[model samples]
Target: MTAARPGSREPGDQEQPGGGAGAAGAPRVPAPRGGRAPGPAAPGPGTVPAVRRGTAPRQRTGRERTGGRPGAAPGPEGDGRLTHQELMSLLGVWALDACSVQEAACVEAHLNDCARCADEALRLRDAVTLLGPPRSLDLDPQLRHGVLESALARRPAVRPVPGWAAPYDAEAARLDALLHDINADEWDIPVRVRWFAGEERAGRSLTVAQVLDHLVAMDGLLARAVGLPDPLGADAPADPLERTETRWRLVTAAGGDSGPARLVAARAWEEWREQSRELVRTAARRGGRTGEEMLPVSVCDPGIFPGLGAAAGPRIPLSDAYLNRAFACWTHAGDIADAVDYPYEAPLGAHLRLLVDLTARRLPGSIAGRRRAGLATTRARLTTAGAPGRTVHLEIEGAGGGDYWIPLDSPTAAVTRVAARDAVAQVALADVEFCRLAAGRQSPAEAAVAGQGDQAAISDVLSALTALSRL
Candidate 1:
């Protein structure tokens, strides 16, 4: 260092008490606390920092603490300068709050002096935000508005959905609401698609996104049947499961399955949503609106959209199809919920009632078919609408509960005698439980709660309900 000339102060020299005098000896006013203060004499050794009474001691800047060199920061090895590499290495540990007291002080002190390290530390902090543990299944706050907007856009909120399409509209919306709550990675989490197969509970494991793909593909079949565009083109299989495989393969070929899983799943989700809208719209339209329903498209599997498990059935009316698919939607939503360990509830009571009514209506057909297949013992006697000779009273007991007499002879009848006296056997089930049975979650043939009168007749009815269930 160059020697200072006599009577000339250095850049870092401090004013000391009773030392230098100004011209005419006028006293200088001291700066207030929290502002600049006079420093003690340059220390030879072991000098303690001075503390001002009644005021907090001033904190030294990184530069001042490191001997007044600009951009220098405090170091771990007391009084020694920290190398740029050493400071750079501590950034991540500091961001994570894992640094030791001295080490942290060193990194923090250096951060302000290095702009590159400062920027990197900021990015590290931003990454830390995603690592926080999740505590609830509460959906993103923005999801509610988006769903509401979509609903209002489809039709005025004040207009009641037609009864035939109401059940489907409600169920599809419920399932979509549930989907909104899933995390991005949860889309690929494994879930089992279950149904009663013959005498056992049969299940197939599928990722959450695959389930959406299945729903989309199947709903597309229904849309195509109603003159809406087919998502998988004209040659897609009419079988629900088969068409689902084709949809997945197309997604793979189009590179949808190879991208970030959330993006791929999102595409499938949008398609399913749009397919649902088209189906619902078709169900709502009448002869005045368009002649779209004139195009005949045959779809197999009564579990087509909502039932999703039946194979090779005659084409049903669009309204009835929506109700059937709606029930299946609820069942499959349950499947997805179970896979992700999320809580789900049965459909609204009125909606549940529609499912029960539809299931009851379809039961006669199921029994007739099963009898043909030799799975049912009931003797088939073909009869027209309202000509019921032998009938079982299906008395659903809870939410959406009512009495209905199912014809033993004819499956195509529009109405049958619901009289109590004509009933040979009566079966009662909770609305939710009955729907679950119909969804193939449990074997109806071995049901412990089959109600009243003839045991053989009750078993046939229960088995018929299970037969309607598919994935």
Candidate 2:
């Protein structure tokens, strides 16, 4: 939080200010030297430092005068020619630091005279105050261990699937192979065996089989939202009615050991899985005919509903759907696999790339809002795997606008192989910290790893993901 010295080399160009820079014509005084007492010195030409009566005098920067008169000439580096915005940013940074009340009062007085800076200062103050102090929470040691251990144990195995291939074909092939290895009559057997000997029997409240079913159901809801045909069959009842019936059946089937709500959720998931499979089939067929067509629907759009309503016109496109489904399935599959002791594979390169692109493109608005509010600076750095030794820089412009990208790389070329859909998946799965924040289970700062701090940056990323869900 040290103030930049006049004529001093600027910190790294990447450095962003918490508040705006100093106003034009303001002198850039050297920050106080370490614990040294002020000595008598005549006021230097063009200097204007604050002075106290009856005390050993310190030189003043001409800009320190309170007469509302113009100050002396700016330094050789144009020390005082900062825009109102820059001044606000600087003030914000200073306020966040440990400064004397008197010093803050000086800045406040200047801000009142400069209308533009005044508004920005207010916004910055609000953001800083709203973000508040970081909270401290004691986590259950066993739960913490379980969370980390699960992630570590299920490290994704990255096998490169062809970037040009359709994900549904690959998934179907895998499913077919799996089914071929087991009798059709035993399709229900895995569920039964899992029920008897799975995590549920080991004292966990939910079983691996239950988790799988739940994910399957959630996928169905996604498909329906996207306007795809129902997978359970065209005649399948509407989701609400079907869910109600499913719950009743589960309660009766389990002899009341399982609650009605839990059963309903499980049945809903079964339907969801069936729908997802059907969507895959449709996607594969379309690909066979057209090489690859974009699906004209988007599940992420806020307009889409669980059932009854058609997905809004102009779908998100088929290729995008492939990426999205792959990401969704892959991540959730990993979750189930971890719970059930199965191998989990990461998505292909194209899928991962798409995810990165989406994340970069959509998160700036949220960041901008936070920055304007003075919650944090607009500048943020993102570090990811594969793209090692490079950082993605994000700069927020306004409440919901800005630019983000890696330096020295073309956005189109860098993200050509990436899928927007997959980006959502990665955020949902691999970035569990973000997911927890999005789920409201933790705050942004608390989720950040120590020494790798940047809660504002992480929050921006989470905000983008949340936006997608709204979309």
Candidate 3:
């Protein structure tokens, strides 16, 4: 959907619901120490037992015999009582500290039915187990000592660029070049109609025209932040006839047809292209780092900007800005490409993967503690389509002897295999969807289910990711 134009009235700014950077009542949890826990063992033969709260494990008719190993606790007995799944969740927290193989198996069986529990179990496993091998690196001791001493000696000053800030200059240039290549004839339509009128995909609704508007506004803001004269009129008269009148002066500078809104939109497009090119040139000459490195970078609360303002922050690291902006551009470009019936061509997926890995490795201790419990490994088949004709035999293993095989390269379609652990939670959604959810625009449940093959696993991953994001 098209974003409201700059300077337009917005909804009352409210903190995003649920906890994260800008959420209300978010808790401060400790960082996780290592990697994730192991997978769960597979349930062998017959119908897997269905466990629910208030149902006694023993008293139910047609219940399978609990062939639990020796020294195993008796399964719950009675209606409306804790079922195998509930008990596993309870034990999942403690699995890292100590849990028997049989206990893990029982929990895995329960997880097959409960998505939430499965997700939790996977998180706990990551926290307690998945420690990567320690790396040994050689460094100059004197340099290290000097850097530390310098850090301790003085507080670093946050400085603004002497001229216009040049954050994202390269990207801006690329965008300008791309816009120039598109037919000038096509620029004369409403951005929404041009980009998203008939698109039917999750991320494709925001059209290129909408994206242009956003970029123009953003560039203006960035320029203002660095003490540059606003290239587009900062105080132009609002045009009553414009679709979005807040930035009317700037929009009007770009000529369009007199009667039809389409003509206005086309003129706006041309203006945006020219202004964007100028901004990129100005940005390139300015000696500034990425937006993230700009200390005290001001951002409004997402409550003010609908989907855009939730994760605002000041002087965020350059890496973070690059990640956020890259994701935004890439995902939206994917949408535009889809709308235009073109192949998607973006390289941000690798960067996204890196972000996930970093976030996973640095989860807080409280969240990590949860993952440590009852961790096991299992093998399952994985498949992906990006790679051509290559099949990878993935070994999935976890706490309860959970093992399966996956064709890592051809995982476009979900394939069912014998798995006690919810594979989807452990691998896919947990690492990515959680961050997006915390940033707003998605429900925890929705993120959990995104691209998930195993609902139970997705739930577990969601819980862990939610917990981690809060931390």
Predictions in order: lDDT: 0.63, 0.37, 0.35
Task: Work out the TM-score per prediction.
Answer: 0.61, 0.34, 0.34
Say which prediction, candidate 1 or candidate 3, comes out ahead on TM-score. 1
Report lDDT (Cα) of residue 459, candidate 2: 42
After TM-score superposition, what is the CA distance of residue 171 in candidate 1 from its true location, in Å? Answer: 2.1
Please give, for residues 1-471, the per-residue lDDT of candidate 2 as tens digits. Answer: 011112221001121222234667443332322122355454333332232222332333223322221332222245434344544545655334333333444454455356455555444533544454443222222343355448756883132222323444344333333323433233232221111111012112343334344344434444664467533334544343253345345544766434444354445444545655666655444443332444434333222211111322344434444554444444444344344334434333333344333334334333333344454433533434223221233332222223233221111123211321122111122344433232233343455522222344344444433433210
What's the TM for model 2? 0.34
Counting clashing residue pairs in each candidate, in order, gives 7, 36, 72
What would the TM-score be for candidate 3 when compared with the true structure?
0.34
lDDT of 3 by residue, 1-471 (tens): 111112221001211111123123222221112222232342223212222122212221222334444423345652323465557655443334333434434444444455455455556644433342433221222343366449756864243221122223333433444454445454432232221111111222333555556545544544454455554456622221132334444444644234454444455567666665554454444434443354333321111112111233224343433333333333333333344443433232333443333233222221223334432122232434232221111121221111122222122222333221323333334433434443332555464343435444344333433442210
Better of 1 and 2 by TM-score: 1
Better of 1 and 2 by lDDT: 1
Task: Tell me the alpha-carbon RMSD of every candidate.
Answer: 21.2, 27.0, 30.4
